[model samples]
Target chain A: MSTEHPEEGRVVRFPTGGVSGEVDIGQLFDAHAAYLVRVCIRLTGSRAAAEDIVQEVFVTAHRRRGDLIPDSNLRTWLYRVAVNLVRHHHRSSGRFNRFVDRYKVDPREAPAGPDVDVERVERAHLVRDCVAELSEKQREVFVLYELEGISGQEISEVLGIKLNTVWSRLRLARKAFRVEWQRRHGEGDHP
Target chain B: MSGPRRLMDDPDFRWETDCDLGDEAILHEGLELGALKERVLAAIEAPPVPPEPTSTASTLGASGAAVKGALGVGLAVVAALGVGYMLGAAQPLSSEGVAEPEAVIEQVVSVPDARLPVAAPRVPAVSAPEAHSTEVVEPVASPQPLHRAPAAVEGGASEPVRPAAAAEVAAVVMPVQSEAPGTAEAPVGESGTVVAEVAAPGGVDAVDGSRLDVEMEVYDTAVQAMASGDYAGAVPAFRSYLRQFPGGHLSTEAELSLLECLFEAGSFAEAEAQASRLLQAPGFGGRERELSLVRAESLILLDRCSEALAIVDALGERDSRTAAVRRECKRRR
Candidate 1:
């Protein structure tokens, strides 16, 4: 009964094959892929993993376009999918996921340039590394709340946790980040 | 307080204490997301077989062995069979009316998040010239076959296309016999027809598992379907879950999820009714705001802009997203 191909521009072939209908996922990709990549890179602490998660998010979105709330915020839906993917990636990796989170440094941070001020670069690296060091749950809560500009309630919905839990984790994550920042750059100075 | 902004209202406090934890400037420090956009986009255009890439880090951690090992086979088999079955089954049913339309509600998240939305069984609506609709397709079928192809049915697949989950699929594969009331022993009859069917008129298909609380599995599948963007699959599945366990702990969650599924499925009329019911329900605790948002959306879509505006106005402090939707609805009005 449905006939509108709003995404007539980009056709996403179902993994199961046969020339099916086209979704505007390509437009979604154009609009938000990079934003998602930033969120993924921040959450996972590694570019490779971030890239992997971004791909999975899109593919999942493509797979579940029907469930998408029409005329709703597509960005919110996409963010929810990305958050779930990151959590799943973590859950499946089990301990390895933790290990990757604990020791892994993001590949995106650049080495200090000859002309660049070394102090700011070190401080930034220290800050970034400290961010990567927060426990997975805390890190996730922190990034969504602070970095992604998502609210605690929405974070709760997307992450499927209690609002109190999100607040608690965020509170702890802030303390941990503070401590780590101080530990790295001894006293008074802050980014 | 406003939802997202209330958390860190003071910019100075965040900058002084949190110290740019979520700074966008940091995102592009040593990276160029623009360069990889084309490659990433290309990959999305034609993604590989494995939905999640198994990373080297997975093998290193003490906790991941069981999880990684379990997910690889679990997701592959579940996705292959559960999704594949629905995909092949959804097509003909669209024109054929082989399955109940409301059955599709999202279930569990695949990534242990268990975000449930059945990868709903949907046939892409074939277009006739006059009426135009943007009915999204749920790619329920996987390219690979984890199990034998479902028995052929009229129009196409012979099996009644009920969106099922990996766990439910496994339960159906391994049936347990018990007199327990909720036991979903695959409705066996004179012909040995094992296709997953809703034995009752109200869309309640009990699982073939031995557990007394098979509702969880049903609930899980519905959530999965909902999560999979198969709102068509999610609606009925959520409906069934609500029916099977009206007083069950997850009932409230199921109701809200059903609202979302109906709204997303573009069943504005049903969504409006469901949202009204939810508004009247007794124990709607923390879910009123979310439900109100759904009600607003449904009203807007039904061309009841005034009613929708009233709902949004009552919220007073509307979230940015909802506020935008309100503005659009008014413009249309």
Candidate 2:
């Protein structure tokens, strides 16, 4: 028999032998909710959407308690599930075009901390604009390597691409970025 | 030596110190790169907590309650079967003991509601199979009918049914199949009962429609900016997404992308700030070591060479990448 005590907290007592007693759902929520929200936010770029996804992740987790992986990799498993949910969400929305149009501006130029210098910030924005014009494969490779600082191996794992492909894409992305930078800044007569 | 290696080894083609691009340009690129890394690390490191189950349960209402009751009943049945088997094994031998078994059966049968207190809400006049089809058979008793009253009372305002109400409706509409003999042996039966209880209308369309594609597109756009050396543009694209979805699934990737953009654009301060945020996030356990390396690079761009060297030294113990970068930084110093 399980009982809730206001002072002692909720406790679950198994009758001799059972499925290891009931778990505290609240504690589980406290530990994992924020992470799930963060993942959704990253994938969707909207707090509202992230919140909705977080709710779904919990509801599904509750439904499949028995299928939970052991403690060591529970977070990893949750992330994997969250990733799957985000993928599903993307497929169902069919609004990739609209999203692209809406958020096409340079991110670095956006208003941020007051401590930032206006001139330096503008230059940063210019560079970001340049990178945003690259081919998708090159961009992904550059972001994973130079931006995310992920190893080629990790990038391969995340993007599901070949190792050599990552290197090639990175080389092309770097060369292209340099060329574009020179064009924007004007040639110095050397090249 | 290979052509590429020869070029790399040439004093004129120095990959270190002698920047044909100039110090200002290199510093600008370094700062943006740092900022982009920070964003990615933040996304990767943020925790993944799920929402509260009680709230969902409440919105589910009577249906949720019915499912809980059915689960309780199932548990009770399992317990009863175990007890029955134990009693059978412990019974004394002989013809006279047969009467004792009958008395025991009568005693056990009389305690009907002992195992399930919630089962008493609905009387067992209907046969178990008939009870199972209660919602289908007795459409008038549908929980939806009851929900209409509350929906009207709450102001006919198109407000979604609360989870608790939903649970209640589920309980009222689900068929009571517990009366069937030997049905407890088939565990799959319980699943059907649960499904019938919680099958509330319009429950599955809560997920968002446009968010995922927007994020992917934003990410792609940011990458393009980086490739074209429009570090300024990439920074805002990444930051915009981060602002909209701080806890986004791709925020780590965005953050990293933004960091790189910032670094390349010469926004060292912002790049450092983003990196610090990433390091602070708990979700970055696996990636922190690498992020720290980026942070060090950011520090170096800001002319904080000693601090950058320290970060590189720390990373040197565990990450070869940082160690190599650290050696390069040392040579530059």
Strongest candidate by lDDT: 1
Candidate 2 - CAPRI tier? incorrect
Off by over 4 Å in 2: A1-114, A183-191, B1-333
Q: After best superposition, candidate 2 residue A77: deviation in angstroms?
A: 6.4
Of the true interface contacts, what fraction does each candidate have? Answer: 0.13, 0.00
Quantify all predictions' global Cα lDDT against the true fold.
0.48, 0.39
Candidate 1 on B24-71: residue-level lDDT in tens? 344455666554566555644552333211211221132122222323
Residue A162 accuracy (lDDT) in model 2: 77
Candidate closest to the true structure, highest TM-score? 1
> How big is the positional error of residue A40 in model 2, measured in Å on the Cα after superposition?
9.1
lDDT (0-100) at residue B125 of candidate 2? Answer: 19
